[model samples]
Structure formats: structure tokens, C-alpha cells
Target: MSQEPDRLFAQPLAQVADFVFNEDVARVFPDMIKRSVPGYPTIVENISVLAARFAQPHTTLYDLGCSLGAVTQALRRHVRADGCRVIAVDNSAAMVERCSEYLHSQDSMFQELLPVEVIEADILALAFQPTSLVALNFTLQFIAIERRPELLARIRQALLPGGALILSEKLRFEDAIEDELLTALHLDFKRANGYSELEIAQKRSAIEKVMLPDSLQTHRQRLLDAGFSQVLPWFQCLNFASLIALP
Candidate 1:
């Protein structure tokens, strides 16, 4: 994994374009995500713990939008189910190439890690196999809002009995006051993580156009409508949250 710092947004731009997960972003993703998202480490660690509890024998697990294979690595480290394998998918060719290298490195250091396949394909167009656990860690917000429900429905339909979907997302509050406070707090968090004002503002300009967030109520309702029997929120920090949707 590259240890380069995130400075993509440090310089001023005439027009901050919508963010894309290209080679430049892939190069600094580890540092960028760690500093930008609060409680990211904890969320990644716990995804494995949650996987161990729900992973069914002889079933496949999926890590959608698996940038650099962090969730896939965690699942391989902790999941001990018989005949289980992991399939990590990402749309960014750069991310997929780098992720494959990182997982290959993990293969050398670890013994008997679960078999994994990394593919570069748009997840919305990809076909899912029967899976026990599906992780969408901070990935759903990047999808077009109109297509999200259909995607979730497809995931729900592919899930085997006793399967689970772990979804982590940035949230938008319905209340004006709550939304303003949390948004301020998130900016403060970025400052505390060493991002300068220019970097923060530039990053925000780049992301706001592409990353569309929904309220918790909207998420729960959509999950239920997508055929999930129950939607359980398990973690929250400031304006971000993770949910477990069971079939």
C-alpha cells in the first residue's frame, strides 16, 4: 500500500470537477480515506467481526467498490467459514490493479487466507453470485440515487438465507439545525485530521456534485422496500453511519 499523503485538493483549481477514483486518487486513497472519514478504521475492523458472525458455510462473500481491498483483507483475516471465498469488485481500473497487488502481498505473509478474485467492473452491471455477506462500505453514496433501490434489490435477491448486507454511508439530516451542526462538526474533524482550509473547501467542492447522501429514515425505508426483513443500525459517528440489513 502506498504511504503517500493526500494532496490532491491542496492546490486551487479554476473549476473543481466532480471527484473520480482515478490513478491519482488511487495512489493516495489510503491516506485520503483515513483522514477524510471519521471512524473509518473502526468501521473497517468491525466489518470483519460482523462477517464472522454472519458468514455461511460454502457461500461467497462480496466486497463491492473494494478500493485497495481493505474490507476484503479484513474478511480474509477473520472469516473462518468452510468453503468460503471472497469476490472484490471495483469500477476503477487503477484501484483494481492496485488492490490485486495488495491482496497478493497479503497472500505471501498469511497462510490459508480465503481465496479472492478482484475484478474491474461496474458493480451496477455486475452479476452477483449467491453470497452470505455483502459489504458496501461507503460505496452506495457514489451511485446515482434513482438506481440505488434497484441495486439493493438485486443484492437482496442474490443473498442466501441467513445472509446480511453491511452498508456504510455519509448521511444527510432532515432537520436544518441538525444538518448544519453535523456538517460543521465534520469540517472540524477534517481540520483535526490535518487538512487545511483550502484542501477542505476544494475537496468539498469536488465531492458535493457526485456524492449524494440520504437521511437515515430514507435508507431504512429503501432497504425494507428492497426486500430486507430488518435494517439495524450498528455504528454512527458524527454524520456517518453503518447499517446491517438482514434477509
Candidate 2:
């Protein structure tokens, strides 16, 4: 319930990243994302905008890669208390397990008041019900580039005719100079937050195999190809953007 680090930061690294996750790396993720990405708040702000667009009396919301359910919890406030149910999905068993435990441990008053369900599932091979609001927040880039279209298509089919999907991602800039500038800023932020230059470099090297960032143009094209009627980026902050697409 508390938003500060004292409460949110207390999560163990194993729990945050799941068992294979590095605690130190997990501990610094929040700071790293904030520093590495500009317009991060836009991602938060767009949540309200997206909510208003598709809001219903009791919507069934799906939060893909609900990392520790941080954003998931934030969106709960916007939904009317009795009508919304968040089905949080994540692949990391460790993170899901810990999140479930934490949710259970929440004060009884809060428990009696909110409706949230956290589960472990692969987004790429998921089954969505007819009525659902799907969100892929800063998680789509991690999926293999070739698999994104198929995944999006599946999500589109799962939604009702008027269902909405909100997607946010870290994009690749077109200009080499811009890329370098953003990279430098991100690296500096990491260093300022306690990661050494060497450590940051090593981490980047390790994830290079899996991190795939597409340009904004490429992303919009993909959404259209996936059968979205309107793919509009309502918010853009540097390389980070929040996209709203309709099926």
C-alpha cells in the first residue's frame, strides 16, 4: 500500500527476478529504468488515459509481465472498487510466487477492499477471454522480434470488438548520434545509482542477445498488421512510448 522504497524496496532480489534473477540487478532495476528511459512518467500518466477510453462497470484487465505488480497496483485506483478484476500474468515463477504471497500478506482491510489475481503464464502462448483489457507495459521488447506479430494477433482475437490494448516499449532510435546520446545518459544514470561503468557494460553485454528494440514506425506498422484499427501513440518520452491500439 505504501509507495515509498522502505516498503516496495524491501522485496528480496530472488523474489523480484524470480530464482534465476540477480538480487543486486533486481534491486537496481527501478532506478535503472527511470534513469535509462525518458518520459517514464508518461507511461504512468497514459494509464489514466487508457483507462478512461475502455473503462466499464467491471472490466477484466490483463497485465502482461506484471513485474511485482507495481503498475498493476497503480491502475487499481482508477478502476471502480467493485467492478474491476486484474489478472496479472508473468512468466517468472519466482516473481509471481512472491507477488502472490505479498498480496496475501497485505492488510486485511486492503484485502477486503481490492480485487487482484496474480498468475504465472507465458504471454506469447496465452488464451484471452472475450472481454478483457490487455496491457503489455515495457515488456514487449523482451519478446523475440519474430514472435511479436503472432502474439499481438492472438491478443487481438481474444478481445471483444471494442476491447483496448495499451502497450509501452523502449524503442530504438533511427539516428546513430541520438542512440549514442541516449545510451550515454542511461549509462551515466546507472553509474550514479551505484553501478560501476564496467558492471553496466557487462550487464548490457549479457542482455544484448535478448533485448530487441524496434523503432516507433516499426511498432505502429506491427500493430496495424496485427489487425488493430487505430494504433496511436498518446505519449512519447525519448525512446519510451505508450501506445493505445483498438481491435
Evaluate model 2: give its TM-score.
Answer: 0.80
Question: How accurate locally, in lDDT, is each candidate?
Answer: 0.96, 0.69
Q: Candidate 1, residues 72-116: lDDT per residue as tens digits?
A: 999998999998999999999999999999999999999989999
Check candidate 2 and list the clashing pairs: 58-83
Model 2 residue 79 lDDT score: 54
Q: Alpha carbon lDDT of residue 158, candidate 2?
A: 77
Scored against the true structure, residue 104 in model 2 reaches a CA lDDT of 63
Tell me the tens digit of each residue's lDDT in model 2 across 129-240: 6545788888898888999999999888877766689999877778889888876776665566556555555556556666788988898899999988999888875567
TM-score of each: 0.99, 0.80
Report the number of the highest-lDDT candidate.
1
The most accurate candidate by TM-score is 1
